[model samples]
Target: MTTSPESSGGATQSHKPACPTAEMGRWPASWEQEMQSTVNYLWHTDDLLGQGATASVYKARNKKSGELVAVKVFNTASYLRPREVQVREFEVLRKLNHQNIIKLFAVEEMGGSRQKVLVMEYCASGSLMSVLEGPENAFGLPEDEFLVVLRCVVAGMNHLRENGIVHRDIKPGNIMRLVGEEGQSIYKLTDFGAARELDDDEKFVSVYGTEEYLHPDMYERAVLRKPQQKAFGVAVDLWSIGVTLYHAATGSLPFVPFGGPRRNKEIMYRITTEKPAGAIAGTQRLENGPLEWSYTLPVTCQLSMGLQSQLVPILANILEVEQAKCWGFDQFFAETSDILQRVVVHVFSLPQAVVHHVYIHAHNTIAIFLEAVYKQTNVAPQHQEYLFEGHLCVLEPSLSAQHIAHTTASSPLTLFSMVSETPKGLAFRDPALDIPKFVPKVDLQADYNTAKGVLGAGYQALRLAQALLAGQELMLRGLHWFVFSNMAGVTEIQELKRAAELRSKLRTLAEVLSRCSRNITETKMTLSNLSSELMKNRDQVHEDRSIQQIQCCLDKMYLIYKQFKKSRMRPGLGYNEEQIHKLDKVNFSHLAKRLLQVFQEERVQKYQASLVTHGKRMRVVHETRNHLRLVGCSVAACNTEAQGAQESLSKILDWLSHQLLQDRTKGAQASPPPTAPYPSPALKDLVLHMQELCKEMKVLASDLQDNNRVIEGLSRVPSAPDI
Candidate 1:
C-alpha cells in the first residue's frame, strides 16, 4: 500500500491496494483513500454536522468539560451576514427568558476562517413538527394529556405577551417538548428567527407567519373588523394560537384542507370569509368537552372555536368598521377575561377552580375593567350633587317651603298638630285672595331656554376651576376615559376646551382630568422616593440617638400618609342630608357636580370672550337697522345697501383676518383671508338697500307700462331681492 499525502494524525493512510475489494473498486485507489481521509478530517476538526445554503451546524463537545453542544456555524461570505444575525439574536434572546424558549449560551469565532458559531441549549426530544409527524408523534395523546401539553404552550405564550414580545412564527416546528417523568412533557418554544417585539403604541405589522397559522387579516386581507385591528399588537399571536389549538384538537388544521401548498391560500380565504363548518363539533367529543381554550393553549393555540366565538364579537367591537366601536387593549383585555372566566366555569364546573383561574387572570383583566367602568361612570364631579339634587328640586322645591311652614306653625323644626287645642284665628274663613292656591301653567319653551342659559359658558368655567382643585377625581375620571376611548390622555387645556362641540364630551373631560392627574401622580412618586431614601438610610436613623431626629422622620412619614389618604379620598359637593341620601341611591350626584363645574367654567370664559370680541359688531347691526328705518327707506333698498356695505367692509376686515391667520400660521409666510373684521351688515343698511332696489324696479315697470309690448317683456325679467 502507498500512503495518501492528506492523511494525518495517526489515522490509516493508504494510496492503493494490489487487489481492490468491491467497496474500493468503484473509484481510483488514491481517490478512495482521499474520501476516507476527508471523513476523518471532519470527525477530528468538528467543522460540520449539517449543512444548508448559507450556513452549517455542528455537534461539538466542549474541549474543557467534554459536554455536548450544538453550534450553528454561519458563512460570513454568504448572503446571511453573521454580525446582523448575532446582533438581532442577542437582542431578542436577552429580553426573552421563558422556560419554553430555547436559551442561547455563547457565540464564538474560528481564528483562521473567521467563521462564527452560535451555541444554544439543545432539546433532545426534537422539534414538535418532527415528533407529531414521526414515529413518536404526540398526535394521539390522551385528551387530558393533550390538554396539559396545550396548557404549557399557552402559558409560554402568555409569558411572551406579558413581556410585550410576539412569536410571529408559531408552528409545531418551532415548539419542542422536554420530557420530564413517565413520558410527561413540558413544551418549550424555540426559534426566535421571526419574533418581533411590540412597541408601546404599535400594532402588528409584516403579516408574516406560517401559512397554516396565519390569521384571517394576515392571509385573506379582509378589513380587520375587530377593535384590536387599530393597534394589532399581541392579538396576532392569539390568532396563531387558535390555529395551533384547532390542529391539536382535531388532528388537522382547521383552515387548510387535505391538499398541498397551492390550496393553502384558498383555504385561508374560506376561513376568513366563511365560518369553519364544524370547528366546535369535535370539541364536544372530548372526554371533557370544550376545554377552556383561553388558559390551555399557548398565546397562539388559545384561538380555538370557543375563543373565536368570544373574540369575534369583541373584535367586532374593537375592529368595529366604525373606528369608534373598536376596542383598545383595555377593552380587549376586559372582554377576554370575562370570556375566559365563563369558559373556565363552563369546562371545569368547580367553583374553587374557576375562582383560582379568575384570580390568576384578574391581574391581566382588572385594570382594563376598572378603566372601562371609570370611563362609563366619569361625570363632572361638581355637577354630581346638582344632577341628583336638581332633579329633586325640579320635582319638589316645596319640601323646603313645607319645612318652613311647619316651623312657623309650631315650635322651630317641629310640625304643627292638626288637633291642637288652639282657638281659631279671627273668623276662620278662607280669604278672597288665596295666593297659595294659584297654580302656574308649565311653560316648556321657557323652561328649556332657562336650562340652556343656566348651563351656558359660566358653567364651563366653574367646572374647569373645580377640576384643578380636586386633582385625583379628575385623574381617575380621565384615566377611565382614556381606557374606553383609546385616545392619548390629555396634555393640554386647549384640548379640553375644543372638546365642547364634539358629540363625545367624554374625550374632552378626559383631557382636562388628565392634566390635573399629574399632581396626584407626582405626589405619589415623591412619597415613594422619600420612603426608599429613608429605607436606604435605615442604619443612620437607628444610629441617631437624638429623639428630635427620630421625631422629625416620623412627622415626615405621618405627613406623607395623611397626604396619601387625602389624595385617595373621593371628592363630592356637599348636599343636604335628604339630598345626599337621595343622590347616593342614583350614584349621579358626585359626577354631576364635577361635570357641572367643568362646563360652567368653560361656558363663562367663552361667554366673556364672545362679549369682548363680537358685541360691538352686533350693536352696529342693530344701529344700522334703526337708522335705515328712521331714513324712511323701503325694506328692499335698505337691505341692498346693507348687503353692499357688508361686502365692501371685507377690506377693513382683511387686517384682522390676516392677523388671526398669522397667529395660526406661526412661522409660515402665507396669511389667511380676513372675515372677523368686517362687522355684520346693520339692520338699517339692509332695509335701505331693499328700498333702493325696489325703486329701480318701479321705474323700469313704469317705462314698460307706457309701451304694451315692452311692459310684457319687462314683466318677464326675474325679480331681485328688494334693493
Candidate 2:
C-alpha cells in the first residue's frame, strides 16, 4: 500500500540514509534472467532500497500476501565473502525476537540461478542517521527526542547482550526507526552484518566497525595497522555506543584532531592515545588551532544540566581505551537505565539566589531532597520552608517526590528561609505606630467655631484611633522586640498615652449609648402599656354585648320548655302542643345565631378605621425595643474593650517603669535600638489580624450609628395615646 519515489524505468527508489550500510547501484547483469526463469511467482522488485559494494537491497512485494518487504540480493563480490560470515547474519536475525530488533521473514532463491536473497521488515522512517541529517537536528536532537533515542538504543543493545551477540558496528546507521501502531517512533537495530557471538570475558582478534565509532585499540589495529597484540572484547561495543550517543547528542564526533576524523588519522590517534590517564572524550581543535577540551558537556548541549550530569559519567566510563577502566556491560546498562528511571526536579532558594536541578527518584523522600537543598544553598534544614505550586509543602519526612504533581524550570519548588526578614509587615507597622515624641498633642477642648479648629479635632481623633489599633498589634510584635530591646524608651511613653486616650474615648461612647438605650427602653414600655389599655377597653365592650344577648336567648328558651311540658300533660286538649313547642325551639336557635353574627360584624366595622394608625404605633414600639436590646449589647462590648485596653496599657507602662528603675539602679546604659527593617513572624501575623479587626470594627461602628438613627426615628412616631 506504501510507495517510494518513482524513476524513469517505472521503478521507485527507497529512502537512502546518510551513512547507510548499503548504497544504490544497478543490479548484476544475470539477475533479471535468473528471476524470469521461475514458473511460480515469488516476489517482484518495485524499488531499490539500498546497495553496497557487495550486496543490493530492494523494496519487493510478496505475490501471496501483498506485503512489502526488504530483499537483500548478494552480488558476485559478496559471494567471495566467507560462507560463515554470510550464514551468521541470517542466523543472528532469525534468532533475535525483540521489539527493538528488526524481524526477519524468510530466505528465498532466484528463479534459475539458485542464488539466495534475505527478506526483512521494511522501515518507513528510514535510519536514525537520516534523522540526524535533518536540518533541525544539526545541533543534536531535542531533549525529548534524544531521550527516545537513548532508551531505544539501550533496549536493543541490552537485547544483543542477552543473546551473547556483539554488534561490532553500533552506530546511527544501523538503527532504523519504524512508525508503530500508536504513531510512536520505534527505533530498531538493523543490518547486523558485522555481528558475532561473544561473551563478557571472551576475546576476538578480527576487527570490524565504522571508523569514527571504533574503539582506540580497534582503530589502531584496523586503520593504523601498527598494532602489536591486543585481543578485542565485548567492551568494544560499549566504546562504539559511547561514540554513537555522543553523535546523537551533539551532532558531531567527540574527538576531532586537526583536519578531521578521516583526513588526519595520525593526529586522531595521537589525540586519543596520548591522554594522561585515559582517552579525553570531548577534545576537538580547528586547523592550525589550539586544542579545546571539555571535561563536562558544553553549555550548548540541549539536554538539561541534571541529565548531563548523569549521562557524562556513563560516557566517561565507556569511552576509556584502557580495558581495566572501561565499565562492563552490566554496569553500563545500569547507569544508562538510571537516567531513564528518574526525573529532573529544579529547586530555587529565595534567600540564597541559587537554583539546583537534581535528578531525583520518584520514590525519594522530601527529607532527602531538603538535605540536597541544604548542600546547595547552605541554608540549615530547620530554616527551610519549601513551597510547591504556590502551596506550602509540609516537611513530612515520608513525603516522596511522586507526591509533587510536577516541577520544572518554569515552575520550580520555591524555598524560603524561615529566619529571613519580612520588610513588608514592618513597613506597614512603621506608618501607623512609629510616632515621634516631638509631635504636638491634640487640643480636644479648643473652640470648634473656627474652620481650622473643627477640622483639627476630627483629624486628631482619627490619628489617635489609628494609633490605638497599631498599639494593639504590638501584642504579637512583642515576640520580637520585647525579647531583646529596651522597653523604657520615649516611644513607649507615647504608646501608653495613646492607649489611655483611646480607652477614655471608648468609655465615654459606651456611657452615651447606655443612656440612649435606657431612654428607648422606657419609651417602649410606655407604648406597651397604652396598647394594653386600648385592648382591655375593646374587650370590655365585647363582653357587655355578649351578656345582654345571652339574657334574651335564655328567656326564649324558658318559654319553649313550658310549652313542651303542657303538651305532654294535655295531649287530648285542643292544638298539638308538642309539635308547636319543637317549631318554636328551632326558630329560637336560628335567631340566636343571627344576633351573634351581627355582633361580630359591628366589632369588625368599629376597628377597621383605626387599624393603620394602631399598626404604625405597635411597629414603632417593636422596632424601638429591638434597637434598645442591640444598643445594650453594644454598650457592654464597648465597656469590655475599654477596660481591656486600659489594663493592657497599664501593665505595659508598669513593666517598662520597673525596667527603667532597675536599669538606673544597676547603672546599665541603654543601647541604641536595632535598625533591622524586617518584621518577625509574630509581627506578620499581627498585621493580618489587625486588618481583619479594623474591618469588623468599621462594620460595628456603622451598625451602632444606624441604631442611633433608629432610636431618634422612634421619637417622631405618634404616641400610642394620640393614635
- Taken over the whole model, the C-alpha lDDT of each candidate is 0.37, 0.56
The sequence of per-residue lDDT tens digits that candidate 1 reaches over residues 486-600 is: 1111112122222222213223224332332234333334334433432333333234332333233333433333333333343432346335333322232233334444333
Residue 65's C-alpha lDDT in candidate 2? 51
Q: Which residue pairs in model 2 clash with each other?
A: 23-51
- Report the number of the highest-TM-score candidate: 2
lDDT of 1 at 141: 36
Put down candidate 2 lDDT per residue, 466-542, tens digits, no spaces.
32223222211211121111111111212222223333334555454434434433453454455455455444443
Q: Which 10 consecutive residues of model 2 have the lowest summed lDDT?
A: 1-10
Task: Estimate candidate 1's alpha-carbon lDDT, on a 0 to 1 scale.
Answer: 0.37
